[model samples]
Target: MTTPAQTPRSQDLDRIESELIAFLEGRTRASWDEDVDLFATGGLSSMFAMELVVHLEQTYGVSIRGGDLKLDNFRTVRTMADLVRKLTADKDTDG
Candidate 1:
């Protein structure tokens, strides 16, 4: 649950997406396309995937639980940002 102060807005989500995209670019083999499949693009690896989950949890203040840890949820910077937004919204709802 989050207070109003903890809730993320549209600009904040955009900022998070931008930061995440840059983070992936630093770790990947090549530049990224927003819709590119991260796994296929070498943007993420199984060994390092959990690090992303941790980063999302710490950065967005949301928990990634059983059903939320799917590969599809992390397919791109857009998707990852969407996931964080969704999870954060869920927290707002639960609040």
Candidate 2:
């Protein structure tokens, strides 16, 4: 179940997905699906992952740390979107 506030979060997630795809496409000739394993599929590397975290933090204004930096969170495009949604929601709730 999702609330009204989560609707905007969902939109943001979609936007992030598109942006990530664009970024990936610019980096490689490979195409990625939403469920593709970013790391295992070689779509992402540790160094690029750190860059991604920085980008997400700057773009979304969400501070990801501690438990948030797990492999599961960065596994796929969909999972990354979910992580962003969670972080964004946490930030909103805290403020």
Which number leads on lDDT? 2
List where candidate 2 sits over 4 angstroms from the true fold.
1-9
Q: What lDDT is reached at residue 69 by model 1?
A: 97
TM-score result, candidate 1: 0.79
Cα-based lDDT for every prediction: 0.83, 0.85
How many collisions per candidate?
Answer: 0, 0
Top-scoring candidate (TM-score): 2
Q: Write the per-residue lDDT of candidate 2 for residues 6-95, one digit (tens) a residue.
A: 576667878888887777777766888888998998889999899888987888788999999998998888898888888888888998
Mind giving the per-residue lDDT tens digits that candidate 1 earns over 1-95?
87555444767677878888787778664677667888886768887789989988998899999999999998888888888888988998998
What are the candidates' C-alpha RMSDs?
A: 7.0, 4.1
- TM-scores for candidates 1 onward, in order: 0.79, 0.83
